[model samples]
Target: MSDLAALYSEIEQKTSTFCTTYSIACAQGCGTCCEHFMPDITASEARLVGAYLLFIKKDFSLIEKVRQSIGNQEGPCPLYRFDSPFHCSVYPARPLICRLFGACAYQGKNGFAVFRRCKYNEEKTMPEHIDFHSEVPVMQDYSYLLRSLDDQEGEVGFLPEKVASMLDQLQFLAVMLDMDDTNPDDTPNPMAS
Candidate 1:
């Protein structure tokens, strides 16, 4: 696996550990966060997700739908399958923001880190003496890692440029593998009700 892929795996492990330790439970089938927010991601992170799509041979039409949805300010995440059952289609390759969305720590006004519990995880209680600074993966640290790897300007929103770049990268990989670009009109949209 590439360095970026390894880092992503590490991130997944850490976040999973954090959530498990904290008993943070996101409400199943409730995609309020995914519907309301588009995650910020770095170029390297984008590349990883793109690579995964290519590896899975995801339909170009579905990818195009996601690309189009990326620009929709009011729409849910393109990767989120909202119709049959709301879930991330690319959950394994989701960005850091998505992985750590509900279970993270933020620096407080006093420059100390504190646990930022998800509003949806009402049943979980944060421990008083938990070490937020060391336990939780800091966003800045991951951002720095991605910047070092890709050296591209990080994107802060679900912008077209970022999605386009990811698509281009995924297409490039597909081309390298000599994969046929079949007509994707028959591919069903996951967001369609």
Candidate 2:
């Protein structure tokens, strides 16, 4: 796999492990966070997600839906299909922000790390002495890692628009490759090539 893809996979695993260890989890079917908040993603993440939608899922309609939702300031994520069994259609390729949303750690004013849980997770209480900085991945640190691989400077903005922009860039790259008699689909791994 490409370095970006590998890094993304690693981040996912680390986030999952941290959440499980801290008993921080989002309630099933709870779209409150999805509806109210937009995920901040890096350009690399946007490209990966867009590639997943185009190459793996092959869901162009959903891509267009994402494009349409660019200016949508509020409501559920454009990727959230109400009728679908899964809350997030592109769950596997979801960005870091989405993966670490409910269970995250932040540095408090006193220079100590504080554990933050979803408001929906009322039943689970974090330990008083929980050390978030040591256990959980810091958002800024991960963001820097992701951005290091790409020229894109900072948070790529809201997820939908970022995905749309990445998809457009990917399509352009594909066209450029096609002109040279290279079929992007025929390759065993687009990311590796």
Candidate 3:
């Protein structure tokens, strides 16, 4: 779990740098992407989000939402909060796809990095397109690294189902750890490794 967190941190730093260098940014307070998209994420990503929600945010209702959204492939993502400036409920533990989308370049067929402006960027804060010959953070690179860290129990699936499954596993572990004596809810997290 710590390894996954480290990977996420590394991804965040790389994507942020890439976005900054390219002046790519989401329009402020706009969650247009989340509104129409559901991320397909790995087991490790789900574990981190589930742990963050179960232990950190302590939001059971959101967990229920995750469960309810199972089998929903076309969706406004379950974590999306329409009213929040940070629309994602689990921003800190958002999946790799979420971290990379619109913020980093994709590996082009020519074996170089390419970036295009997000259609939802109505503010035109980001560039229309970029062709890069130099090294840049590519989605495919981060994806391979992320998959290497996953335990692959749930494998990769839509955000709702994967997260719900991981949340259940985490909750069962919490109960088995003895809720009355050593409260994992408040203790230093085991990170659900």
Best by TM-score: 3
Tens digits of per-residue lDDT for model 1, 2-26 = 7767887887887678768777566
lDDT of 2 by residue, 1-193 (tens): 2877687778778877877887766666566677676777777788888888877777768888999989766747888877855778889888777766655566677666677666655555444336644646766667677777776465567888889898888766765555322233453434445
Best by lDDT: 3
| Residue 166 C-alpha lDDT in model 1 | 69
TM-score of each: 0.74, 0.76, 0.89
* Winner by TM-score between candidate 2 and candidate 1: 2
In candidate 3, what residue range of length 10 has the lowest lDDT sum?
A: 180-189
lDDT of 3 at 177: 71
Question: Candidate 1 versus the native: TM-score?
Answer: 0.74
List CA RMSD, all candidates.
Answer: 6.7, 5.9, 4.9
True-vs-predicted CA distance for residue 64, candidate 3, Å: 0.8
Would you list the C-alpha lDDT of every candidate in the order shown?
0.63, 0.71, 0.84
Candidate 2 lDDT trough over 10 residues, lowest sum: 179-188
**Runs off by more than 4 Å, candidate 1:** 84-86, 120-135, 153-160, 172-177, 181-193
